[model samples]
Every structure is written in C-alpha cells, then in structure tokens.
Target: MGDRFEKLQDRLRDWTKADLPGEIWHSVDLFDQDDYDILVVPSFSVDQQVGEKIEGFLHYEERLLFSLIRLRNPHTRVIYVTALPLCPIVIDYYLQLLPGIPFSHARERLLPISLYDGSLKPLSKKILERPRLVDKIRRALRPNKAYMVCYNCTELERKLSLELDIPLLAASPDLLHWGSKSGSREIFAECNIPFPDGSFTVTSTEELLEELYELWLRQPDLKRIVVKLNEGFSGEGNALLDLRPILDYAPDKCERVETINALDKQLQNLSCQAEGETWESFSKRIPKLGAIVEAFIEGEVKRSPSVQGYIRPTKEVEILSTHDQILGGADGQVYMGCHFPADAAYRLKLQDLGLKVGEALAARGAMERYSVDFITVQHPETNEWDIQAIEINLRKGGTTHPFMTLKLLTNGNFDYDTGLFLSQQDQEKHYIATDNLQKEQYRGLLPNDLMDIIAEKRLHFDSSSRTGSVFHLMGALSEFGKLGLTSIGNSMEEAEEIYERVEAVLDEETKNYGDRASSLPLNWDKA
Candidate 1:
C-alpha cells in the first residue's frame, strides 16, 4: 500500500506541474472554478511523539475549519472527513453562518464522513485503516479536478492521497522539513534573515550539551536557552533551559561528567510542553525526536508576531496576513490567540521579512500556506525594533481559520500597505481570537445550551453590522471546560470589546450550571 501510494504521489506531482483543460489548480484557486471536489482531511499528522490523548482534544478545534464548506461554490462538492463524527449541532452552527447560500443548498454539496474512532491517531491514519471509508471517499471524488486539503502533510497524508488517487493541495511530505524548526533555521540562513543564535540540530542529550556548551563559550553572557523539538506544535515540544546556574559553576569544577550530570538535572527540571508531561518523560523522547538549543532572545518590550503567506501553483508568493500572537504558559511559549494585522508600527517590516523567506520557499517548491514566527524587541537607545525569525509552520495553524472565516464571511481583502483587513463594503476589519478559553466551572454545558446562551445574549454575528462573536471547540466544553472564540470588530478596540463581552456573558450564563451538573458525554468518550 505504501509503495502504491508513493507511485500515485509521483504521478500527481507531474499532474500539478502540467496544465489541464478547464481545471483550476490549488486550494486558494477553488473560488475560480464552478465545478470541483474538495476532500478536507483535518489531520494532525505530526510525529507520534505528542501523546494521543491530547491529539484527540486538539481535533475538536480543527473541525471549525470545515466551516470552509459555507463558502463553497454552488457547483463544488466538499467532503469533510473526521476521525470521530462532529456533533450535529456543531455542523448546523457553521452552516448557519453562510451568507447568501441556503443551509440546505450548502448541505447538498457537502459530505461529512467519519471513522467513529476517537483515538489519538491521525484522521488520515484512521481513514487508511478503514478500506470501506476509503472507497466511499473515492466514489465521492469529482474525478480529475479533486484535491485533498489537510491540517498538515505527512507520510500518512501522502499515502492517503495515493489511496484516493487525488492530488493533495499541500506541500509534499518530502518538503515538510522546510517547516520544521531546524528546517526554518536553515532557510533563514539561506535567505540572509536575522535569527536568534542557535546551534544546529542535535539528536541526543550529549549533542545538545555540546551545542549549549559551545554556544556558552561563544557568548558567556547568555542567561537562558530554548530547547525545541524539530516538529513541536504550539510549543508543546519546547523546553527552556536556565543556563545561569550552570554558567556560574567554577571553571575548575567544570568536569565533563559533572557538567553533563548538572545539565541532565536541569533538563529534567525544565518545563514540559503539555499538561501532565514531565521532563523525565519528555527527556527520554528527545534523542529519537531530535532538538535544537538556542539562546533565548529577551527584552523588556518584546513581542511575538507572525507573518502568513501562500505559494501559488504558478510559484507566486502571496502575503496573506500578519498577526500579533498572544502567547501563554509558564515561559509564555504556548500559542494562546492572536490579533490580526499585527501592530501597525512594525507590520510592514514583518511583511517584508516574510516575503523574503516566502519567496525562498516558493523557489523550493513549497505549496499552499506557511507562516513564520518572529521575536521582536524595542532597542532602548534607538527605540528601533530588533526582529529575529523564530520558526515556520508549514500548515494551517491557530491563525488560519479565523482569518479564513473573516475572508469568507465578508469577501474581504487584507491590504498590504495599510495592514488592515478591508471587507466587501471597504470597512476596516479586526478580530481577537483564542483557543484556550477553558473554565472548570463551565464543564457541564452542552452545545445546545451554549447556542441558547449565545442567542439570548445576542452574540451571533450580524451580517449587516459585520461584527459579532463566533464560537468554536464547543465539543470540548463539557469535558475539558474549553471552547474557542473569535470576536470580530471594525477596529481593534471594538474587537477587544466584543471578546470581553462574550467572556462576561459566558461566565454569567454558565456560572450556576458548572457547579451543579455533570457534563454530558458526547456519543463517544473523549480521549
């Protein structure tokens, strides 16, 4: 099956490069075509190092991206495949947001297929394990014009594409390294982009120690360093090493054995990427996963911003959006949310850097979407910002869906010069979004209950006003006390206002219910 999949991918590669009659190419170009088929496989096909239980919860949020179906061309057919079926209520909630399209009209062109499995495995993996589902998908495809859209491309996704004999509108698995931390660093170097001082990729603790010690020798003033996995998602594969204590040790006392032991203890005590993940557990997995040790760039006015871009099939680079990422967690490394258009002061600067890197990626055959994360700080003397490229994500991410939703909802365009999202009416748009709004007290609420609350509070988006709140990840609320929110506004202040109001309303509505009732389990147990 693997060999067959590989062979199919080779043919698809050739298909992508060759012109086909009356066929539109690429996911972004789907709007141009009146007839096409889209197979959306929202799979988190990263290395299996990240535990399955967490992966299952993550899937809850990704289902929101399928809201893309709401923007479907009337002649287009969209089949959304999930590892577990989505709640019917969740499906209706998304469909209701379609502008001029009737709910039934969109539904007629839509297909929701599921494996009915809630394991931590990738959705593509689940689909692969079930030949019946594969055949169903094959039968549903729209012949030669069909393409698979995924959360991320991997060998599993590659194989799945072969099984269906459809081209994947994502970077090939072979090109994924361009999105990894190590790969990002290499690209930064190739493109002459400024990046944090970091050591090359290391596979074992010994190699990590060697890199860190070497970096320390070059810059003894380095106080902290970040150790990251090549494929860490949302900072779960990252750990910060406090180098102060180790650096303070006497030169005479720095025996190789003592140094390694001290560093080992420090690594063990360092933070783990996910909840319940211990250094002991994470450290054991580092050797097999590979890592990079880099000096942690710090400053008083530091901010993390990211630039998202897309490479068209014709090798043109399109700068889609920029974001001021909201980071949380002990070290402020985890992805919490983001503000659109980034900060006006440095938005264009970030865009320039993003294009330089994106053009390099386009030249390298990276297709579809990719984003670059950056760390910027204000210099005390000159008040100028110093920016360092941190990493790149070669797939859809936390920032993807909200921007996509806004664009689809309003048929807007992001202006490169002004750093503003302009709607069809030419009004400036802004939004505040987060995937981490979890409260232990809100555990017992059901999807229906939340929708009722939203209605009663007038929280539904108003097409006329082009402003309101949209909820996602409602499936995780009862069990995980988690829900995703995106509050859109005409200005930054307005967006923040909506987000604050929504939070207050949710708190008030669910206040009593959280303490009194047990959350109702969905059809299946959450991992």
Candidate 2:
C-alpha cells in the first residue's frame, strides 16, 4: 500500500507540475484573479498523543481561516474542510475582512464542509475514512485546476491528495525528516550554520544517556541541556536537564561509569516544557519518536527570533518575514506569540541566514512555507547580538497566518531591504500576534458574544484603514477560554498598544466571571 501510494503521489506531482503555470509560482500575488479552486484541509497531522496534550487543539484548524482572503480574487473558490462544523458567525467574521468584495459574492464562492466528527484523529484522516466526504470534496474541486493546502503535510495528507486527485501545495511526506530535530541539525551542519552543540538522534534511553554523557564531556561547564523529541512542535516535546546536580560526575572529576550512572539517575529530574509531562512519560516516547540532546544556550539577555520563507514550485526561495517570538513555560521554551519585523539590528541578518537555509531545502526539493528559528544573545562589551540557528519548521507555523493575514488585509508586500511589511499605500505595517490569549474568565463566550464585543469596541479590523484586530480560534473560546488574534498597526508601538487594549477590554468584560486575573502583561515593555 505504501509503495503504491508513493507511486500515485509521484504521478500526481508530475501532473500538477504540468498543469500549473510557472509564472504563478513566482508571483507575489498568489491568486491574482486567476481561475482556480483551493481545497483547504487545515490538519495538524502530527503525533496524536502529542497533539492531544494541547488544550483545544482542534480549534487550531481555524488558523488557516486567513486563506479565505483569497476569495477576494473573484475567480477563485475555496472549499474548507474541518473535523466539525465552523460557527456561522466565525465564517462571517472572516468574510467581512475582505476588502472591496461584497459579502454575498465571497460567500457564494466559499464552501465550508464539516465531518461532524470531533474525534482526536487528524482531519485529513477523518476525511479519508469517510468515502462520501472524500467524494464530496472531489466533486467540489475543479479537476486540474485545484490544489490542497494544510497546516502540515504528512502521509495522511498525501493519501488525501491522491484520493481527491488534487496536488498538495506543501512538501512531500517523504521529505518531512528535514523538519525533525535531528534532520534540522544535519541541515544546519550541511549549510555551515552555527547551532548549539548537540548529540545525534537517539531512539533509546541507553543511547540518550550515552549522548548526554558525551555532550557533557564536550561542555563540562554547561549549566543546562535541552532534550527535544525529533518530531515535536511548539516546543512541547522539549525538556531541560540541569547539570548542577551532576556536576561531581564531570569528566575531570569522576570516572566514565560513575558519570553515566549519575546522569541516568538524573533523568527522572528532567524539567519538561509541556504541561503535566513527566520524565517517565517523556522517555517512553523516545523509541517511537526519537530524541536529541543539545547544550542550552544561556545568557542574561536572549531573544528568540525566527525567519519565514517560501520555496516556489520554480525552486526559487523568497524570504517572507522575520519576527521576535514571545515564549513561555518553565524554561521559556513554549511558543506564546510574536512581534513582527524582528529588531532592526538583526532582522536583515535573519533574512540572509534564512535564505541560505531555504536555498538548501529548495535544492533538496522542499516547497512552500518554511521557517528557521534562532537564539540571539547580546554581548556585554560590544552590545552586539550573537545569533545561532535552532531548528527548521518545514510547514506553515504560528507566524504564517498572521503575516498572511496582514498581507491579505493590506494587499502589502514584504520589503526585502528593510525587513518591514509595506502596504499597497506604501505605509509600513506592524503586528503582534498570538494563539495563546487564554484566560479562565474567557470561557462561555460564544462566537456571537465575541462578535458583539468586537463591534462595540470597534476592535474589528478596519478594511478602510487596514489596521486593527483580526481574531481566530473563535471555536475554542466557548470551552477553553482561549482565543487567537493578530493586532495590526502602522508601527510596532502602536501594534503593542492595540494588543494591550484588546487584552484590557476582554479582561474588563470578563472580570466578574472568573476569580483569577490573566498573567499576560498589560504592557509590552514588562512582557
């Protein structure tokens, strides 16, 4: 079945190559009034166990709702599939953001299909299991004129693409290794990119221990090491190992067997980044998912910045944007959100390094969106930032939708020279976005309730000014007290102010409902 599936995918890839025009692949305007059908299956398609750990994981499907902006092209139709039906209010919210296009006209070209199954399986797999749903999607799409887009591409996505006879506008499942922790390290080495000292991929507790010991030998002064699952996302699969307790087992101070034994004993003390994660549960996943160990780069002042880029079908690489990510968790490893147009000092440097990585991936046949994360530390003396590559996300990630939303809203383009996004009116645009605006007080606010808040506060994105708030993850609000939003403005300070205002408004509205206040800072500087 696997062999046949691969052959089918290869054939489909060839057909898609011949069907789509080369010029469309390189153009900044993706649809550009072109006649085409877009099949959107926003499936995470990750390890179900890991995915289930996230609160309101299914609602993440709404992240790609930004794709609805493509409907503005007039000649394009979109078919969006989900595990469960989306709220009409949520759909209406997105459609209303379209500039110049009439609401009824855009709705006419849109089709939102739901499987009515809220099971934990990937949405693509659910669709595959239902022959009727598969057929429904196939019948909706125009043969030879449509392509599928997803949150991430896996074997399930490939199978779905084959079943629908539509090409997937993502990297093939076979090349997914490039996105894994070990694969990322290999690419960094091949590209001569600087990364933390790390171990090769390991699949067993014993191998992991040996690698940890070796890493300790190399960096005896290392205070901490990060253990990451090869296939983790959003930093959930990461754990930190404190070396202070095992300092006596150092290479110079102790023998090999003693050091190894001490390290093995300390495994139970690993500080996991994921909520409710334990060393026992984490280590159990090693054999199935593989793991790696790397020295944790430590500094008094550090920033997590990432660069997003795209690999066109023509194999040309384009840097899309750069952002300074806001992280949280025990060790500041979990992704919370981001500020666009990364700090001026290193934004261009990020683009240069990102281009190298993208070119490398494109040379290896990677396509569509990819992002490179980095750890930048400031030098006390020179006050210059030292940058080190971290990992490669070979899919549309947290930064993708917000940047896409900004582009679609303003009809803007990323300025390569300045690393700033320029609107069609030549005004600079900035935004602060997050999928983690969660609060206990926010629960029970239905889509309609949220819409009312938006309307009353004038928080809704203004099509005329092309600045304000754009929200997603509306489905999660009722149950999880969580919502996602992108606050846009003409400058970074204004963007942060907008985000703070939104946070304040939500807090004021929900104040009487919950006991605890949100931990998120009300000011950007404090954050």
Candidate 3:
C-alpha cells in the first residue's frame, strides 16, 4: 500500500505538470471544451469534532458548486461524490437554472454517487470505509483525462486518490502545515507582509500566558488578545481575553499572581467558537492542537477583508476575489458571510498584500486555492486603513462557495485591477452570501417544500434582470433548521436588498414550523 501511495503521488505530479488543456482554464469560455471529466469531492476535511454537527449536510451545501456542471459541454462529464444521496428534487432545482442548457442533457452528463452514510465522521473517512462505494467510483471513470477536486486535501484525500487512480488538483498533504496558524505567521514574515503583534505555535497554556505578558509589556495599553487553535475553522477554536484589567496596574504593582488571576477569569468567560463549550473543554483542546495568542487589533473603524488566491500547478499565482467579511460573536471575531469584491476603498491594497502572500505560497509549491485573512483598521489621525495579515486558510473556506456560485452562474471573472466582477455579457455583478440564515421555524421543511415556496413566490433568479437568490444547506433545513444562500445583483445595494427579501420570505413561510427558535445565540446577523 505504501509503494502504491508513492506511485500515486508521482502520477499526480505528472498530471499537474502535463501539457495545457485549454478547456480546463477557468474563463468565460470554459464550456467551449470538447471533452473532459471533473470529479468533485466536497469533503469538509477538518477535524471530526469541528465538523460533527453539520456532517449530514456538508456535502449537500456544496451542491452550490455543482452549478458549474451546468456550464460543461454535453460531452464533458461531471461526477459529484457525497456521503449520502442528494435529494432528486434538489438536483432538478439546480439543473433548471442553467440559462440555455436543456435539463435532460445536463442531467445526463452529471452523475452523483454517495456512500449512503450520514455519520459524523469526515466524508473522506466514510469513503475509505466503504470499499464497495470506492469500487463503484473507480468503475465509473472515463478514458478521457480527468482531475480530482476536493474541498480540501488531507491524508484521507491522498488515500482516496490512490484508490481511484486519480490525481488531486490540490496541494499535497505534506504541505498541510503551511495552512496552520503558526505556518501562516511564518509565511507572512518571510514575505515581508505586515501582520499583527502576536506569538504563534504555542503548545501549552503556560507558553500562551508568557507570550501574552511579553506582548502586554510591549504595548501597555493593549485592550484585548485573541488565542486561536492552529487548525480551527470558522472561528470555532478561537477565544479572546480582556487585557485592560491587567494593564490598569503599574509595572511594579502588576504581579504574576494578579496577571494569572485576571487571565483565568477572562478565559472562563470567553465566547467560545463551539456551542455549549466550556473553558474546561476548550482548554483541553488547546494543548492537543496547539494555539496562538496575538494582540487583537482593535479600533472603532476596523474591518475584516479577505483575499482569495490560487497557485496553479505551473506556479502561476492568480488572485481570485476579495470579500468584506461580516463577523459576529461578542467581539466580532466569528465569521458570518461576506460582501463580494470587498469595500472599494481598500480592495486594491488588499489584493497587493494577497499577491505577496500568494507568491510566497507558490514558491513553497502550494497549489490550488488558498485565502489570506486580514484585520484592517483606519488610522484615526489620517483616515488611512492599515491592513494586518491575520491568517492564511490553505483550503476552501466560507468565501469559496459563494464566489464560485457567482462565477459559475454568471460566467464572470473578478477584475483585480478595478475590484469588480464582470459577467460574460460584460455586466457588473455583486452578491451578499451567508450560511447563517438559520432558525428553528425552518426545521422540518424539506427541499421540496422550499422549492414550492420559491416557485409560488417567484423568488428564482431572474435571467432578464440577472438578480435573485440561490439556496444551499437544504438537508440541514429539515433537521437542523439551517439554510444558506447567495443573493446576486448588479450592485451591492441590490444584492443586499435581495438577501433581505429572501430572509423575509423564509421567515413568513416557515413561521409556524417546529418549536420556537433555538436558545443558542445566533451566529450571523440578527438585525
């Protein structure tokens, strides 16, 4: 098995370095390709505990990316693998949205296979456990050149590629460390990019405490600090501390006892990333996965803008898109959704920083998609924003699906120079997307029911005006009462308006279903 795995790695290298395929290049004319095959594996690819709650619906939400299959030529096949079967109605719903493609033709070319298990384990693990399912996938391969695309690549993904005799079009698992919080900070420094004042790769609470004290000494007026898990996603492994109380005392008066006491108190009261998580549980996790403590960049005029980029196998770095993330939580540290192309005022600056980071990643042999997150603050005196590179996600993140949805649906490209998305028809495009439009009343509502409401209310995307809502997380709605959506329009205001209308429609339709709203705090915009 080890020898076979090594052989598979060699094949993957050859595939990535193979001669050019004009059709595979992502552009407005991607559909013009004559023949090819794309096998999409939308695994959460995170720790099992982090993905536990949403295991059943993770792949279902990725169906949003399947919208790209609609753009493929009839001769080109798309194989979408999932942990469980997708709702046929949901499949039909997306197929009907393709502008000029006939539903039957597209459906015939698209294939969805599942493992028939909805357990809390990672989808890759589930696939590995089901040998019959793996064999089924192996048997479906065509003679044409193919590429395996995943939500993120890890050890399990590498194993799956060997089993299926396919090469992943992503970074090798050996490069996984580059995506961690500690690695991100190192990369930032190596590239000469500006980052926050913090210490990374701290393995214990003691080390973290020492680092905090060091930072406090450097900046006596520090108000807060953030401690993050090296591998946590969507802010679930993040915790914050208030440093104001400790700073209140003079240097001689500030004793270690007093400092530790204050730190303990703040940690116990932190707003953890996971629901129902206590300081006891979170503390245990910190040592196991490692953590980083950094001085929180605070300002009344602060914003979190992220830049998405990709390095092809050939080492060419491409800036994909930028977003102004809408954060939530007590200190606005958790990710919600985002506005596409970021805020026009500083998007170009964000892109420049992103490029520096991307070049560094490419130099290190990183491939496929990665995103650099930043915390930008306005200078009170000059009104100029100073951007601080926060962390790098070497995988698909909250911004990936939304941006891909817009790109595939409209056949558009993000213009890095102008910070705008232009569709194939040369129309300007924008969108507001979120995965947190969740409510208890939304429970027990199946995909079919949601489709009915969309049809009756006429909420489908309007081809004539190029505006409307597209829904995801349908599987979660029936059980978890969670739904995700992207509202696309010609401008930011229009997109936001469309999002508001969609929320209103869902609220009105599902008002009486299930119990009252969950007691858990809303993670997204409640206003």
Candidate 4:
C-alpha cells in the first residue's frame, strides 16, 4: 500500500510540474488571477499522543481560515475539511474580512466540509477512513486545477493526496527527516551554521544516555541541557535537565564511570516542558520517537526568534517573515505567540541565516514552507548578540497564519531589505499574534457572543487603516475558552497596544461570569 501511494504521489508531482507555473504556486500568489480549486486540509498529522496533550487541538483547523481570503481573486475556490463542522458565525466572520468581495459571492465559492467526527485522530486519517467523504472532496475539486494544502505533510496526508488524486502543496513525506530535531542539527552542520553542541539521534534510553555523556564531556561547564524528541512540535516533547543537581559527578570531581552512573540516576529529574509529562513516560517514547540532547544556551538576556520562508517548486528560496516568539512553560520553552519582523537589531541577520538553511533544504528537494528557530543572547557589556540555530519546522507553524492573515488582509509584501511588511498602500505593518488566549472565564461564549463583542468594541481589523484585530480558533472559544488572533498595526508598539486592548476587553466582558477561575497570565509581555 505504501509503495502504491508513493507511485501515485510521484504521478501527482509530475502533473503539478507539468501544469502549474512556479510563480502561481507562491503562497502569497494564491490570489493570482488563475482559476483553481484549493483543498485546505489543516490536519495536524503529528504523533497522536503528543497532539492530544494540547487543549482543543482539533480547533487548530481554523488557523487556515486566512486561506479564505484567496476568494478575493474571484477565480479561486477553497474547500476546507475539518474533523467537525465549523460554526456558521466563524465562517461568516472570515468572509467579511475580504476587502472588496461581496459576502455572498465569496461564500458561494467556499465549501466547508466536516466529517462530524470529534475523535482524537488526524483529520487526514478521518477523511481516508471515509470513502464517501473522500469522494465528496474529489467531486468538489476541478478535474486538473486543484491541489491540497495541509498544516503538516505526513504519511496520512500523502495517502489522502493519493485518494483524492490531487497534488499536495507540501514537502514530500519521505524528506520529513530533514525537519526532525536531529536532522536539523545535521543540516546546521552541513551549512556551517552555529547550533548548540548536541548528540546524534538516539532511539533508545541507553543510546540517549551515551550521547548525553559525550555531550557533557564536550561542554563540562554546561549548566543545563535540552532533551528533544526528534519529531516534537511546539516544544512539548522537550525536557530540561539541570546539571547542577549532579555537579558532584562532574568530569573534574569524579571518574568517567562514576559520572555516567550519577547521570543515569539524575535522568529521572528531567523537567519536562509539556504539562503533566514525566521522565518515565517521556523516556518510554524514546524508542518510538528518536530523541537528542543539546547544551542549553544560557544567557541573562535571551530571545527566541524565528524565520519563516518558502521552498518554491522552482527550488527558489523566499524569506517570508521573521518574528520574536513569545514562549511560556515551566522553563520558557513552549510556544505562546510572536511579534512580527523580529527585532531590528538581528532581524536581517536572521534572514541571511534562514536563507542558508532554506537553500540547503531546497537542494534536498524540500518544498513549500519551512521555518528555522534560533536562540539569540545579548552580551551584557559589548551589547553584541550571539545567535544559535535551534531547529527547523518544515511545515506551516504558529507564525504562518498570522503572517498570512496580514498579507491577505492588507495585500502586503514582506520587505526583506528592512525585514518589515509593507501594505499595498505602502504603509508599514506589524502584528502580535497568539493561539493561547485561553481563560476559563471565556468558556461558554458562543461564536455569536464573541462576534457581538467584536462588533461592540470594534475589534475587527479596520479596512480603512489596515490596523486592528483578526481572530481565529473561534470554534475553541465556546468549549475550551481558547481563541487565537492577529493584532496588526502600523508599528510594533501600536500592534502590542491593540493586542492588550483586546485582552482587556475580553477580561472585562467575562469578569462578571460566575465561578470564575483565575486568569492565566497573558505571556505577550514576555515578547
């Protein structure tokens, strides 16, 4: 079955190469004046166990609602599939954001299909399991003018692509290794990029311990180390091991055999980034999913910055945007949100380094979007920043939708020279976005209730000024009290202010609700 699917995928790839012009396939160019059908399968086809840990993970499908803006072209049709039906109010809200398009006209071109299954399986798998659903999708697409886009391409997505007989606008699943934690380290080495000192990929506890011991030997002064699952996402599969607890076993204090023994016992003390995670359960996954250990770059002042770019079908690498990510967890490793264009100090440097990685991935036949994360530390006295490459995400990530929303809303283009996004009106744009605006107080607020708040407070993005708020994950609001939004402004300060205003408004609106739970601290301030 796998071999047959691969052959079909090969044919689909050949079809895409023969029929589509490279320029037309650019992400931003979805609005190009070409007739095509876009099958938006925003499936987070990751390890189910890891994915289940996230609250309302299925609602993430709404992140790609920005794709609806493609309807502004008048010739493009989008068929969005999800695990469950989307709220009509949520769909209407997105359509209303289309600049000059009429609501009814855009609605006519959009098809939102739901499997009505809320199971904890990947949406792609759900579709593959239902032949009727697969046929419905196939019938909705134009014979040769359609392609599928997904959150991440996995074996499931590839199989779905074959079932639908359409090309997937993502990297081939066979090349997914290049996106893994260990594979990312290898790419950094091949490109001569600076990443933390780490061990090769290990698939068993013994192998992991061996690698950790070698890493300690290389960086004896290292205070901490990060253990990452090769296929982790959003840092959930990461754990921090504080070496201070076992300093007595240091190379200087004890013999190699003694140090190894101490390290083995200390492994149980790993502080996992994922909620409710334990070293025992985490280590158990080592054999199923490979893991790696790297010296944790430490500094008094550090920033988590990331660069997003695209690997064009033509093998051209295009840098899309850069952002300073807002992270929050027990040890500040989880992804929370981001400020666009990163910091001026090193935004350009990020672009240069990101292009290097993109070029390398392109050479390896990687396609579509790819993002690289980095840890930048400031020198207290010299004020110089030291940047270290972290890992590569070969998929549409947290920053993808927000940046795409900005482009689709204002028809902006990212100015690589300045690392700023410029609107069609030539005005500069900035935004702060997050998918973690969750609060127990926000639970039970139906889609209509949220829209009423948006209307009363004028929280919607302003078409005239091209600065305001655009919300996503509306489906998660009623059930999980979680929502996502991108607050755009002419400047960084303005963007932050807008986001703060939204936070304040939501707090005020929900403050009177009974049995109120303490609000989770908004981590935007950390950015």
Give the distance in Å from residue 483's predicted Cα in candidate 4 to where it truly belongs.
1.1
TM-score of each: 0.91, 0.94, 0.90, 0.94
**Local accuracy of candidate 2 as per-residue lDDT tens digits, 1-527:** 45665554454346436556555554323544556788999998887778877999999999989889889878899999988789999999889878789999999999999889888899988999999878888998887778888999998998888888777788888889999899999999998999999987899999998999999998889989899999887899999999898898887799999999998898899999888899999999999999999999999889999999998766778999999999998899999999999999999999999999999998887888999999999998898999999999999899999998998888888999999999988999999999999999899998987887888888988878888999999999999999999999999999999999999999988888566554445684666
Tens-digit lDDT track of model 3 for 181-274: 9899999999888998888788887787777777776777788888888888778778777666555542345886676656766677766756
RMSD of 1: 4.3
Please report how far candidate 4 places residue 275 from its true position, in Å.
0.9
lDDT of 1 by residue, 1-527 (tens): 65665555454456556675544454444243345677889888765666442533545535445445434667777888877667788888888887677888887887888777877777788889989889988998877767788888998998889878987777878888888889999999998899988877788878887887677666667778898887787888888888777764422357656766677677766766577777677767767777888889979999999999887755678888999999987899988899997998888988999999889988987778899999999999998989999998889888888888778667788898887899978999999998888887778787888887888789988888899988888877877878888899999999999999988988887777635544455553663
lDDT of each: 0.79, 0.88, 0.77, 0.88
Candidate 4 local Cα displacement, residue 78, angstroms: 1.3
When summed lDDT is taken over every stretch of 10 residues in candidate 4, the lowest stretch is: 23-32
Window of ten residues with lowest summed lDDT in model 3: 23-32
Which regions of candidate 4 fall more than 4 Å away from where they truly are? Answer: 1-22, 27-30, 514-527
